[model samples]
Each structure stands twice: as structure tokens, then as C-alpha cells.
Target: MKRKLWLGAGLSAAASALAGIAAYAAHRLSGPTAALKRETLFAFTPFETGVDWEEVRFNSVDGLQIRAWWLGRPESKRVVIGCHGHRGRKDELLGIGSGLWRAGMNVLIFDFRGRGESDDSICSLAYHEVGDLHGAIKYVEARLPEAQIGVIGYSMGAAVSLLGSADQPAVKAVVADSSFAEMANLVDFALANRRLPPRPLRALADQITAQRYGYRFEAVRPIEALIRYGQRPLLVIHCTGDTVIPVVDAYDLYAAAQGPKELWIVEDMPHCGAYFADRPAYVKRVAEFFERYL
Candidate 1:
């Protein structure tokens, strides 16, 4: 009888431990974000290409200051905006932005709130980020009316580009790299990579994140936006060796894109590391898209 009682006690302890783990995982799924570190692994800049840039700032819909670097002549109406990924700063997009500017288009690369020089208090990942993108469009329009606007986004920014363009009629072109179909799927992918099963845990995470952020993850589907984008020109690129976001995701995005669209598969690249993996080819492809559409 004592042995049986001990066995029951052990099972109860195990159940309690498992429940505790699930709770922790759900909380982590909300994904706390911080500012990018003072340094980066790559050296991407416009100075190397010998172009003078202007400092610029604009306020997001939520009244947060978004900082950016603007290049190209004041009279130019062809503008390209570069959106950085999670925990990213503007300079990280210098390589791509410089290439666009060289191709005779204005370029603006900015920081999202809680990431770089922008507000550092909170980051709702891609949910709150769409507002920042809207503010950028407004800023450019106020300064250069009747301008043709294009956007290139990486990772989280990639998803935001597609989501934001759904409402902005002026967005002429978009290039998205290494974006997940949905935020919840991304959370599940991250957990699975760590050897954690993402079943009930992912559901809990979804609920917790929605309650905290005041929005549902189901509403941030970029794939849905691509279907509705309607002939504005979309270029979706994915790296083959990306473990964080399976390369197969690019196929779905490409297939969903209804209008003039192109999909490029980067060979043996990882995550958002495509541009750095092959700078020349990456720049040429992106520039060609904007050249055709913008």
C-alpha cells in the first residue's frame, strides 16, 4: 500500500512539473523584444558607395518617433523604403538601400519602435509595426506628393510590408525576404526547433499574446494581403537553408501573389542572411523589381 501511495505521489509531482513548464512556455511565446545591440556582424553602409544622406524623423500613428536616413535628390518622386527585421536598425539595410538609390530612386531606411533609435519601451512584434510603416508613407507623401513608393523588408519587416500595403494604395512595389506566413506559426516553429512540442502550448501562447497586445495573430497574415495586393508587383525571396523559417513558406507566398510577381530561391542561404550571402545578385534582383514597378 505504501509503494502504491508513493507511486501516486510521483505521478502528481510529474503532472505539476509539466503544467509549470507549459505556463512558462506560453509566457515566452509573447516574445519580449529589446533594442539592437550597439554593434552588428556585418558592415553595410552607403558611404562606401559614396552617397550623401540626410537625417530624417517621423512620428508613427501611436506618436512614437521613427528615425531614418533619406537619400536621393529632393526632386525625385521615385522612392524606396527599406524595413529592417526584429531587433534591427536602419544601417543594416544600407547595402540594399544604396543600390536602390544608385538606380535613381529615393531611399528611406528607418527603425521600428523598441528596436533602434525609435521608442524602446514596447514591441508587439509585427502587430504594432504596421503603424510605423503607415507613418513612413505619410511622411514621404507630405514631402513628395504623387511619388511612386516601393518597400523592401526583411524577416519581421517582410511580413509588415505585405500587411501594411493592403491599405496603402500608393505602394507600387514590395520585396519580402524570409517571412513566415503567420506570427503564430513562427512562434510554433521557434518552439519546435528547441525540441518543444507546440500543441496546447502554442494555443496558450496565442491567447496570452493577444490579451497582452490587444490584437489577434490571425489578423496579421501577409499571405492574405498578397492575394489581395492586385498587380502592384511583389517579389518574394527565400533562402534554401533557412531553418528558422522553412523555405517551403516562400512557395505559398509566391503562389498566393495574384499579380505581376516573382519568386527567387536563394541557394544555401540561412534565414535573413540572403543579402549578405550574395550581395551582388541580391541587389540586382531587388533593383530590377523596383525598376520595373516603381
Candidate 2:
């Protein structure tokens, strides 16, 4: 009887420990992330790319202030919005924005809330950030009533673009680079990679995350969002060497998409490494995609 009691106690304690660890991980995942140093990562701006830009600010649906840069004029009628990835700032997208601007499209790059120059908020891992992207679309529509908008996003931004613009008719095309298909699968993969117990922990972490942030990990499914695109064009870009998000996700997204879609899988590049691999090719492909579709 004593040994049974001792074993029961040990099992209870172990379960409690696992639950605690899962809770901690959940908070860390949904918590505010430290912003990267913009100047260090991006040495140049729109000026260096020979485009004139304006500093702009808008508010998200939830009333969070969003800071952005508008490159090129509304007269272009075609606009491309650049969405940066996790912990990254608008500065990181200047290169892509400059390319789009040179391609004769107005470009808008903004910092997601809780990242840089935006209102501080809990990072719901692109769930709530969808509102931020919508705010950007509204800003574009207001600036250029005849604007045909396209979106190019990397990693989390890619996921946001998929979710945020699914029902938005203003966005004509999307280029999703290194986006995850589902948040739950991503959490499972992340926990497993860290050598943590994934079964119970995954569900528990999601529960805690939802309790804390009012959003569930399982609810953000970019794969399902693709079905809503209908006849709109989508370009899924991923690298075989991407470790942050499996290249399989790109394939999944492409398969799930119902409309006119294209998938480009590059070799020997990490997450979002395709741009750095060959800037000119990357720019040309994206610019041509927008020109053809938007």
C-alpha cells in the first residue's frame, strides 16, 4: 500500500511538472517578442533604391496604431504590400518593396503590432495580426480607390497574408514565402524539435495560449484559407533547406489552393533565404507575378 501511494504521488508530481512547463512555453510563444535592430539588418532604405516614400500610420481593427511606409504614388493604381516575419521590422522588407516600386507598383511595408514602431500587443502568432494586415489594405483602398493590391509576406507574415486577405477582394494576388499550414501542426513540430513531450503538452500549451491571449493555436489554418481564394492567383515560394518551416508546407498550401496557383521550390536555402540567394531573380519572378495577376 505504501509503495503504491509513493508511486501515485510521483506520477502526480510529474504530471504537474509537465503541465507547468507547457504553460510556460505557451506564454513564451504568445508573448511579446523583442524587435530586431532595423538599421543593422537593413543598411539602406527607399531613398537608396531611388524611390520617394512617405511615412504613414494607421489603426488596426482592434484600434492598435500601425506604422508604415508608402513608396511610390497612388497614381500607379497598382500596389503591393510587404509583410515582414516574426520579430522582424518593415526595414527588412525594404529590398522587396524597392523591387516592387521599381516594377511600377506602389509599395507599402508596415510593422506588425508588437514588433516595431507599432502598438505593443501580445503576439497571437498571426491570428490577431490579421487585423493589422487588414488595416493596411484599408489604407491602400483609401489612398487609391482604383488600387489593385497584391501581398508578399515571409514566414508569419505569409500566414497573416493568407488568413487576413482570404475574403478581401481588394487583394488581387498573394506571394506566401515559408508559411505554415496550421498553427497546431507548427506547435507540435516546434515542441518535438525541442525534445519536449508533444502529445499532452501540445494541447495543453494551446489551451493556455488561448486562455491568455483569447486565440487558439488550432484556429489559425492558412491551408483552409486558400480554398477561399477562388480564381485569384497565389504564388507559394519555399526553399528545400528551410528548417524553420518544412518545405512540405508550401506543397500543402499549393495543393489546398483552389484557384490559379504556382509553387516555386528552390534548393539549398534556409527560411526566406530565396531572396538572398539571388536578388535579381527573386525580384523578377515576384514582379512578373504581380504584373501578370494584378
Candidate 3:
């Protein structure tokens, strides 16, 4: 009788453990569910720059409808695709997009899959967001074949931009801002940001991630893409005081870049806060970089 009782308890415990793992995995896989709407994404739309803007949509490689805005400046031959940070919507990139527009470039600012007015889904971080960018490039090429194109991305968008540029030859130049070297460190940051302590569930998380995403987090690396980028006028930007993504990643990417590349480190600038620290310098450098390449 005691043996049977022990066996039942063990089975119950095993079932509970499996249940806990599945629950945690689902929550992590689901990611953040909230996102900004179109109006909110463009609250300051038609930016003070007075660029006429129109809402646009593009289908991702996987057929997800991506929400975007076209900031068209009359007779602008260059188009800069502005990619926002993780969990950030299209409107948040208006400042940067406007800067590019003022520099005599048109801007296409869009939301990644899970953020803003984009298709409803969980953020894949950069795993599949790369497809979103590829879709954007195709959309631009198909609609405006005569214009030169470039990409300026923030955080996750930066990583995806680099990855996309590796495959999209039409992307003339790239500006990757505050991007992570690998997705593993990003997972750690995500947990810490939520104040969740690291635990032994890492293996379970990895398994779950692989099962759902069809690739391990370690494989979603941007360094490989940067290495393949080979002397293509790449610009890597990072802030010294960025607590989210360490500055070391920037150094690694700069060292790994085999082509014409520039790395800019801002003192005391937080993550994605390069412009916030010194708007004038940021504007001048970025505009010049694009002008030099695109």
C-alpha cells in the first residue's frame, strides 16, 4: 500500500513539473501582447518637419500585414527605412525618420510584427522580424524602383536590419543602433528587466523556444550577419551607459565587420538614447553617413 502511495505521489509531482514548464514556456513564447495603435504610433505625425505622410501596409514574408507610414518629401530620390526598437511602434521612429527626411531622404517607418499597429502576434524579437524587414525592402523596391534605399534601425530592429541587409542587396547602407550581439544575452536582459531571477528553467526555455520558433536563440545571432555584411557601409552605434545591451557587443560587431564600417560610442548615453544625448551631432553624423554611402 505504501509503495502504491509513493508511486502515485511521484507521478503527480512529475505531472506538476511538466505543467509548470509548459505554462512558463507558453507565457514566454506569447511574449508581450500589448501594442500601440496607428494614431498613437503617429501621434506627432506629419512631423513638425512638415513632411506629408500617408499610412501604408506591407505583407511580410509569412504574410503578416505590417503597418507603416510613408513620409514622402517631394522629389526625394533616397528612401530611408526607419525600424523602431523592440516593443516600439512606428511613431517612435518619427524623430529619426524626420531627421533623415530633412536630410533630403524619404522615410518609411514601420512597426515590427508584434508592436504598434502591426499584425497581431507575439514579438519574435529578431528571429522572424528579419522577414518583416525583407518584406519592407521588397515593398519599397516594387513601388519605387528608382529610389536608393537604406535602413536605420533601433535595438531589435537594428539586429533584424543587419540580418536583412545580409540578404537584401538592394539595401545600400545600414545603421544598427543598440543591437544585441546574440539573442541569449537578450533573454537574460528580458528576464532581469522583469525582475525575474535566473533559474534552472533555461534548458526548458531553450527547448520550448526551439520547438516553437524552429531555431535556437543562439543561432539568431547578428554577428554572423555582420560578418557577411563585408564592407558595405555599416554603422554601429551604442551608448556607454546602456544597461540593457552592453557596449561590449558593439565592440565585437565592429571587430567582426570585415568591410567599410564605423562604430560610434556615446558617453553617458543610455540605450537608444544617442540622439537624446546630442541631437545635433547625431543628426549630422547619421545624415553624413547616409549621404556618403547611399
Candidate 4:
């Protein structure tokens, strides 16, 4: 009887340990997976070969050095700053940048910290990235004080733009694609999609980010920013088939935003592929929107 009781206790302890390991693994894998695959997305063979581009670097307010490219006609006065998504470098944005350049707009594309050539290996999503966007805007302002400025951001980049636009009044127009309404919602979606149990682990991740970054993950709400300061010409685009970040978040952002705002729901496109799926339509719609606003 004594031997049997000891065997049962050992089995119970082993089971508990296994369960803990599974939970930790699931949390790490699902919480914040990088969406961009550099080898898969950055092949330059398909794009225009001889486009004008100059490598540039600048300093952020926090002293982080950022690397980017300036594309299009060098003497063009109209400019649009394009912010790439989390895990994505500026190279992935060249397709859209090319279109904007053809439309007579100079384009600047850069990576957020930790993603591309930028300094630092930590990303606080948009909570810290907004500061980077502010730094980029300041860089543009110093060079083109009299030029009208527009911004286009994707996913995490979009959230950063929404938050940054609230603080910077010089931005003439804003475009966000497949953006999340809140950072916590993104965490929750990622967890659920991976079929991971999300009780203590999710809470722990939030706690860790807050303790390290001095801001709660839940507090980085882009919908709230839209409600408060989405006054300029805004274009919110999302795809119905965006499994990574739900389309509903874009709807929520559009509903909260006031003034000259429009929401475009692209059918059958996944995540940020709306532009690639229909290049002509995407360019036409975006160009028309910017023409009306900027």
C-alpha cells in the first residue's frame, strides 16, 4: 500500500511538470510571432531594377540610429513616409513605394527598431515604435518643412502611426492597413489561433512587458487614439481574410474616427496582401484618396 501511494504521487508530479512546460512553450510561440520572412519577401528580382534610391541613416530622440531609403524623384516636393510592419524591413515596402513614386510622391521607408538595420533587439510593438515614428517625422520635417506629409503604416506600423499622429499635427494625411485596435487584442488573437491556453501565461507576458517598458500592453490602444485625435484625412484599409489581425479591429478604428475618414474592406486578400492581389485597384484607390486629402 505504501509503495502504491508513492507511485501515484510521482505520476501526479510528472504530469504537472509536463503541463507547465507545454504552457510555457505555447506562450512563447504564440504571443508575438514575427510575421515577416526576409528570405521569402525580400527577393528584389520582381521589382523595377533602376529606381532611384539613396541609403540614409538618422538618429531617434532616444539616440537609436535608424536606417532607411529615400526613393523617387529627388526634386519632388510631395512626400509620403511609409512605415513597415513588425518583423518587416523597408525592402518589403518597395512595391507600394514604387507606386507612390510613379504618382510624383517621394517616399521614405524605414524599419522599426529590432526589425531591420535599426539599432536595438527589443520591440515594444507600437508602444515604443510610436517614438520611432515621431523621430522619422521630425527627420522629414527638417528636410521638407513646406511639403505636405502623408503617412502609410501596416499592422504594428499602423498602430504606431495612429498613436504618433495624435501627438504630431504636421501630418497631413494618414493611411493604415490591417491594424489592430489594441495590442492586448493582438496578443489574445495570436494565443487563440495557436490553440494555446491563455490564462496565467498571457497575464505574465503583459506583466513582463509592463515591468520592462513602463507601459501596460493593454494601454496601447489605437482605437482610443482614433476616437480622440483621428481628425485629419484618414484611410483605414483591411482585408476580410486577414487571419493574423482580424478585420473587425479596422472596423472599430474606423467607427471611432471622426471627420474625413473612409474604410475599405478588400475581399479575399490576406493581411497586407491587398495591394499585391490587385495592384491597379490598390494604386487607384490610394492615389485618389491622397489626391483628395493632400
Candidate 5:
């Protein structure tokens, strides 16, 4: 009887520990929710001037309403679809859009569903966000048929654009900035950075994501996507001081790409701040790259 009692107790303890790990993982993934709220609430504080902004909305394949802005000179022949990072809306992309616009490219900046004015409240990371990119691409193709299309995506948007471009042939060239190699790696990095146990958190996050989205986070590996669909020219820009997602991920992506690619690492710039860190250099490189490729 005592042996049986101990065995049951051990199983109970193991189950409780597993539950705890899962909870931690879910908490880490939940970080974006609050961040999104903060960004939306303070959306008007930044970008006081430059570029004309117009509110626009379109329907995603899943029927979600996506919100965006058409910035700069609408008559420009060269066009760029700018995808904002997680928790960021089209307004946040104004700085980059203005630069691209001044470089003589029309910029279309949009917010993914569940962000800004778009419908939905949950982000499936890039797994479902790719659909948003497809919708944006279709919009661009229909409206700007004669224009050469290019894409600039940051973080989560970068991952979606990369995957979406792999599926769509119209994307002439791509600029991916501060992107993660995979959703699982991003979660693991977050947990480790917070001084938490990574394995348990990752396992839990995988279970939760699969239960909620019907797919595994590992299945959305951007590095693998880059390797598989490296036929188009890619420009990878990363900041050496990025603490959220390591700069090494950008290098890994650059190295894994099979086709023509360029990697630019901005010294001491944090996260997506590379553009602001060296505006002139950023504009020059981006213009030169698209001029050559597109």
C-alpha cells in the first residue's frame, strides 16, 4: 500500500510540474498582448510631420479587416509595401516610408489583423499573419500592376513577408529587418532572457499554440523558409545591439539564403532602430539595392 501511495504521489507531482511549465510558456507568449495595447494607446505621440497619410482598409483571406495607410507620392513608379513589426501600426512605419518615398518609391504601410484598427484580437504570430501579407500583395498587384513591387518588413512582419513572398511570385525583392529564425526560437530567447527555464516554457508554448492555432510554432521557421525560397534577392538588415531577437538570427538567415542576398549590421543600434541610427546610410543602401534589383 505504501509503494502504491508513493507512486501515485510521484505522478501527481510530475503532472503539477508539467502544468507549471506550460503556464510559464503561455505567460511569455502573452507578452505581445500588453505591448500591443500600449502601442495603440500612444499611437499619436510620434511622427509629427512629413508624408501625407490616408486611412485605408482591406479584407484578408480569412475575412479579417486589415487597416493601413498610403504614404508619400502616390504617382511614383517604384512601390514598396511596408510591413510593421509586432504591436506596431502603419503610423509607426512612417519614418521608413518617408525615406522610401523620398527615394521615389510609393509606400503602402499596413497593420496586421488584431493590431491597430484591424479586426481580431489574437496574433498567431507569423503562422496566420502570412495571410495578411497575401491580402496586401493582392491589393498592390491590383492597384499597381505596372509598378515593380518590393517589400520591407520588420520583426513579425518580416517573417510573414518572407513566408508570403515564398508563396507569391510577384515580390521582386525583399528587405527583412530584425526578424526571428522561428517562433519557437523567439519564445526560447524570451524565456532565457528573463532568466526562466527555456525547455519547459517552449514545450508549453508549443502545446498552447498548437491547441489554439492547429499548427506548431516550429513549422513557421523563417530561416527554413529563406533556405527553401531563396530565388529572389534579399536584403537583411539587423542591429548589433538588439536584445529581443539576436542579430545572429539575421546572419543565419543571410547565410542560409541560396540566392543573391546582402547582410547589413548596424553597430550599437537597438532592435529596429538601425534606420534612425544611420539614416543617410540606410537610405543610400536601400535605394541602391532596389535600384539594382528591381
Candidate 6:
């Protein structure tokens, strides 16, 4: 009986330790990390590309300040919002902004909360970032009431734009690149990459995440958001070589879109590498998409 009691105690302690470790990992994954906060030059910029731009700032619904660059004059009614990927800054979208600027479209590229010059806060991936994107749209609407707005987003930003624009009539079109279908899939992917089993740990992490962050992982489904996004033309782009987000997500998004939609599956490129794969073609295709839909 003594030996059995000791074994039970040891097993309980081990289970507690595992749960604690999972909670810590979940917190780190869902919050801002150094990589997500780091300022890195991963893409060509509007400055280098020679486009007219003005620095701007706006506030999220939760009162977090967001910094952005307006890449064209207010004279044009066509506007596109550029949303960068996870671990990315607004500078990374400047190239795309510059392209759209030349296409006679106003572009707004902003940093999500806890990134670039924005206020420091936890990143709930696409969950909290939806407010930030909505803030950008409000800023643009106030600046140009007659504006026809579209969105171009990469990875997490892609997810954010989809979620933010679902009920927003102001946004008319969306180009989502390398976006995940579900938040749970993302968590599972991370777990699989680490060679960890995703069963109980994933559920435990989700519970801990909701308790700590005030948002459930299941609430961040862009696939479901697309279903609610009515009549907005969608262009779902993903690379075949994207390991971060499966190409099947593109198919799911395309199927979920309620309006006119198009899918572009690029050949053998990494995550969000469609732009770098063929700059001119990518810009032309995306600009034409906004022109047609927006």
C-alpha cells in the first residue's frame, strides 16, 4: 500500500509538471516574442521603391496605438490595406504598397499591436489583431469617405484581414496569402513540428490560453469568417512549398468565400514567397484583382 501510494504521488506530480510546461509554451506562442517584435528588413520598401508616403498613426478599439504609412494621396478613392505576416513589420508591406500606389491606389500599411512602432501588448494572433485592422479601416474611411477599400494580407495578417472584414461593408475585396484555415490547426502544426503529441496538450493549452488571454483558440477561425464575408471578391494565394500553412487552406478559403473568388497556387515557393518569386507578376495580378473587385 505504501509503495502504491508513492507511485500515485509521483504520477500526479509528473502530470502537474507537464501541464505547467504546456501552459508556459502556450503563453509564449500566443503572446509577443522577440522574433515577432524584432525589426528586420525582410522585404523591399516603398522608400526604396520611390513612392509618395506619409507617416500616420491610429488607435485600436482597445486603445492601443498603431503606426502606419499612407502610401498614396487621398485624391484616389481606391485604397488597399497591406497586412504583414507574423514576425513582420509594416516595412515588409511597403513594396506591395508601392506597387499599388503606382496602380493609382492609396495604400495603408500598419504594424499590428506589439510590433514595430505600435504599443506593446500581447498578440493573440488574429484574434486581437482584428481590432487593429478595423482601426486602420476606420482611419481610411475617415480620411476618404468615398474610398473603395481592399486588403492584402500575408499569413497571420491574412487571417486578421479576413476576420476583421467579415461584417465590415467598407472592405470590398481581400487577397489572403498563406493564411491558415483554423487556429487549432496552427497549434497542431507547431506541436507536430516539435515532435509532440497534440491531443491532451492542445486542449489543455487552449483552455489555459482562453483563461489567460480572454479569447478561445476556436474563435479565430478565418475559414468560418470567410463564410460570413458576403459578396466580397476573394483571392486566396498560397505557395505549394509553404510549410507554415498548408496549401489546402487556400482551397478551403476559396470554397468558404460566399462571393466571386479566385485561387492562385504558386509553384514551389516557401511561405509568403509568392511575391519574391515573381515581383512584377505578383503585383500585376494583385493590383488587377483590386481594380476589378474594389
Judging by TM-score against the true structure, name the best candidate.
2
Highest lDDT model number: 2
* Candidate 6 or 1, higher TM-score: 6
Evaluation by lDDT, superior candidate among 2 and 3: 2
Q: Rate the local accuracy (lDDT) of all candidates.
A: 0.80, 0.88, 0.80, 0.77, 0.79, 0.87
Once fitted onto the true fold, the runs of candidate 1 whose alpha carbons sit more than 4 angstroms away are 1-49
Model 4 Cα lDDT, one tens digit per residue, 1-294:
999999999999976754665445333422332432244344452145457778777777687888788875667667788888876777778888878887778788887776667776346677777877888888888877776778899988888878888768788888999899987777788877877655544676676566554567677899888765657888999999999999999889888888799999998989987897889788788877776777
Structure candidate 1, residue pairs in collision: none
Worst ten-residue run, lDDT, model 5?
A: 30-39
> Which residue runs does candidate 5 get wrong by more than 4 Å?
1-18, 27-42, 45-47, 72-74
How high is the lDDT of residue 26 in model 5?
A: 59
* Model 5: per-residue Cα lDDT over 1-294, one tens digit each: 999999999999987876777665654453344445444665752246466666667778788889887665666667788888876777777777777877877778888876777876557677777888888888877877877888889988888778878867788899998989887888888878978778876887788767755568777898888765758999999999999899989988998888889999989989988888977788888878887777
Give the clashing residue pairs of candidate 5, or none: none
Off by over 4 Å in 4: 1-49, 212-214
TM-score of model 1 relative to the true fold? 0.88
Per-model TM-score versus the true fold: 0.88, 0.93, 0.85, 0.84, 0.87, 0.92
lDDT of 3 by residue, 127-242 (tens): 77888898899899987898788899998888888888887778889999999888776666656666654343545566676776566777679998876776788899999999
**How close to the true structure is residue 23 of candidate 3, measured as C-alpha lDDT?**
45
Candidate 4 C-alpha error for residue 167, in Å: 0.7
Q: Residue by residue across 1-294, what tens digits does model 6's lDDT show? A: 999999999999988976986797677757644446875445445668798888899999899999898888657789999898777889888777888899889999999988888888877778888999999999999999999999999999999989999989999999999999998988888778778777777898898888877788899999999777988899999999988888888998888888999999999999999999999999999999999987
Whole-model lDDT for model 2 versus the true structure? 0.88
The better-scoring model by lDDT among 3 and 5 is: 3
Clashes of each: 0, 0, 3, 0, 0, 0
Q: C-alpha displacement of 166 in model 1, angstroms?
A: 1.0
